[model samples]
Target: MQESTYNNMNAARSSKRWDNWEGHRNQINRILHERVLKSSSTDFCKAAIFGAGNCDDIDLNYWLNNVDELWLFDIDLESVQQGIERQNIDTKMIDKLKLFQIDVTGLDKISFFNDINQMLKDSTPIKKVVSYIRKIANNLEVIDDLINHYGSFSFVASSSIHTQLLYPHFNQMLSNTKDKETLMREADYLMSTLVKNYNQLLLNLVKENGTLFIWTDEFELSSDRGNLHLLPQFQREILNSNYTFLSKFIYNFGLKGAVECNKDLLSKFPNFADRLIDKTYDLIYWIWHYDLTKHYLIHCFIIRL
Candidate 1:
């Protein structure tokens, strides 16, 4: 698909619906603070968040208390604005942390347009066509401006919620393209943009020995309903190449016996009135013994940079 089309689709889909999974969000943040932040000596002064949904801002504020400068960037500017307001964070902090609405899928539009224009200039019809396409492609500047403004950060984080939504849009856009090789090439290019953006953010923001924390849903790795089964190699590559092992913890539901305990609580509170009671018990167990078993294998890792 053309870069312009992809960016519009990405922006539209992002605006429609996006949210942080509450249970998973808290669990990951807890592990990050306890295992990573507490152990590291480097005080994190700056942080950047991609897909900066409202809930995630709350999670970051709760865990990363030392962060003096916070940058929130997302394709959906309204969402970021809502997050800032909902969190009641100081406007000064919001000002210090620039927000950019950037689409990461438009890396080569300028070069492609310039090349096409130069090649077709002698033919009026071709020139007009190329000029139209160039206008469409050039709209990618919305995202380019984001990269220019934010530049980089010390800590960068993004949740898997983006991949699940964006990948299908990309796949659909490429499905009808005449050149299969070009379609695949574009797909790879977009993915590389994500990696490059993430890597550059990490490299620029993180101190030599700083940490990068990625919080993803446990279901992404589960066998029965997990997408991880589809790309086992890619999953392994990310874990192996990008991160160093620190510690893993589970949250929300407990490992094994804890699940059973939750089940029992549900049984006792079969009616709606017992909902709060059951939730309280589950919360207590999740906080205390979630890391002990394999059943609740919501993995949380602290990676050393």
Candidate 2:
């Protein structure tokens, strides 16, 4: 998707989701308040959330109450405005909630999608497409104007968009290719490059000793792949199992192949295990019943840097 189209897609999705997810919203707000905001010692002068579409899973009032300034970044401003309107925040407090429209992935800055669409339009061979993505991946540089302009924040959070950064690109390529295996390999490389740099961007946004809260949908559940009926049992198993055991369970249950993004292969993204302090971080999982027919397994990581 081009940046404009992606923003429009986000706005449409936000409108549909605006009034739903009450329980999910409360759960996410509670987790962040208890596990990140309350646990941190940084002066609550500034905080920010990337991919803050419609801000459904956040308690806007609480954020305003805690931070002297709150920044919300999404590709579209309409959705952020819609989110603020939904919260019914006091007019006085509205001053503290600043909004920025930007693509956090920097994919738009590099015209990643546009290049690929052009290649496909020309019917470029799959090998050349693969090489193109690799070239872009190797040369990728995160846009830093956010830091240059607004400086760092006391707290930084990403609202379940790590997977989304690479999704549209993969879907676009998939639509034009029959050799899925070859495309998957290149998409995997691109996902790694995008996610890793995105992670670093999150880190860069945080002030020293501040906290970063990253949550993402790591796997899916439904009748087709892993029976959703077995979800309860699977959740129970994970509760008692260590990380190693959990990895084995995911593989044994055939979940590794079914996820939108396989956790084990993507630097265990969002978990940011590589940045773990003393091998410790706050981690939690919950089910997002996307609708009557679909469900997602969401996990969040709380890292204090």
Candidate 3:
């Protein structure tokens, strides 16, 4: 990926997400309140977030009072800047806020630095936009660099980024290749390995005994009437994946049974249970019925450790 890919985000994308956050602001804050603030172990002096873009859903005031520093990370620096400005925070308060523009998944590292340089030099027609991504598809590798760099956080949170593991890369491959079926085939072959490695990366980012709160909206189910339900399943899927595969590797389960992830065959990464503080965890799977059609099953994991 180009340095530009590493540095910033697409303006349209960052703008649209910010707009979406405005409509979702209240519900997001409400959920954070219940899951994080209500938790007895939510206090921390400094913290880092992987998908802390726009900060629309982040609990700024809580951090302001409890934390001495708050690090906001995203692929888009502009979105982070918008979050800082939206807070209307004072200069002294702003000093505690540090912005990191990065794609935690590691393959997407083309920064705004690359984009600006390409424009200044007048590169090929659309190479600046398309080339970096094409390179990414071919250059993918296992990554666990978050632990090497910003490894520790008192409290870690994921804002709908886990299930999005392969989505962006999948989309980019579709766009660069412009053949959906071909891209799908490639994804079927490539994604499991990528996802397994990425999932490991996510877990390793947590500290040895820090609190982790992950809320993800994935898993869809359909009713008899043809309506679909978007349910949450990060923890369940992870547990199932771990149970299915790690059992085979570590416990030597029978090979007669079959299980799948994303309708693809399943394999396990390291189980998260080994990382839990007391292994006393709570998983809240509840639907946030915003309207008749826009119901989201929020998969909330309150893991102490």
Candidate 4:
């Protein structure tokens, strides 16, 4: 499957190392070990990681030690392949690894089941056309493909990929959508419903008794004036004196707007909250931090189920 233009850009972004790798990665790894993996009731031998883009952002040891067989899924296969090569992953782990190029937006679903490294290198516009033409696509094949070929995974990690599924389509709509009221009302409604359904579908796809991990950006905050710097307690703690990520948005619900961007997501979630899969707060956290780069505030949700 072909990746959207924005996704390709994001994958390219991961090619560069973080400015504060020591501090940023250290905190991230500590959270994976202390909050996520350590709290798991099951040691998943067979696992699948969604949005496993350039695995630079992940703590490799978590998968290497816990999973015997690992499946990596992403919009761009080249990014993940490069991630694996960059990590110098052991040959044994690579042997058990499977990769798939997929887009969960129902817009794009290309299965390079044989080799993820091989992808369609069409222009961004053309790829989007192909993807948009398949807007009603169902990705049940993604999980079924995994099970049929490699068997079921005990765990699924949707690491910051959900919101990204909507980026390209949302942009396309916004650009073409002329009516201001339509942009607010119609766009908001579409985004809210899509976000809710897309998220629930991921949970339903998991095998029985399987654990799922979902970490994503919740909201973005920006001030017209450049004097906003207040952050939540957790952000202050994890990134004490660190300025690596000020306001980087990865996965986002199609809830962007001119104002009330934060409350927009909250207001939308309530409409479909009842339809969501039941989840426990075993390891869940929320943070609103200053985005030094974009000069925005980011609300992030880190949860394990």
Cα RMSD to the true fold for all candidates: 15.3, 4.0, 9.0, 8.9
Worst 10 residues of 4 by lDDT: 112-121
Clash numbers, per candidate: 3, 0, 12, 5
Q: TM-score each candidate.
A: 0.48, 0.82, 0.59, 0.61
Question: What tens digits encode model 1's per-residue C-alpha lDDT throughout 14-67?
Answer: 321224235555655665566555545665456666556443424645634556
User: Ten consecutive residues with minimal summed lDDT in candidate 1?
Assistant: 281-290
State the local distance difference test value for candidate 1: 0.43
Decoy 4 TM-score against native: 0.61
TM-score of 1: 0.48
lDDT of 3 by residue, 64-160 (tens): 6555677777776776676667677866676788777666555445343244335435644444434444455466665544556444666666665
- Superposition TM-score, candidate 2 onto the true structure: 0.82
Stretches of candidate 2 off by over 4 Å are 11-20, 42-44, 149-151, 173-181, 223-226, 238-280
Collision pairs in model 2: none
Q: Pick the candidate with the highest lDDT.
A: 2
- The C-alpha stretches of model 4 lying farther than 4 A from their native spots are 11-16, 19-28, 39-44, 109-151, 172-185, 221-228, 232-280, 286-305
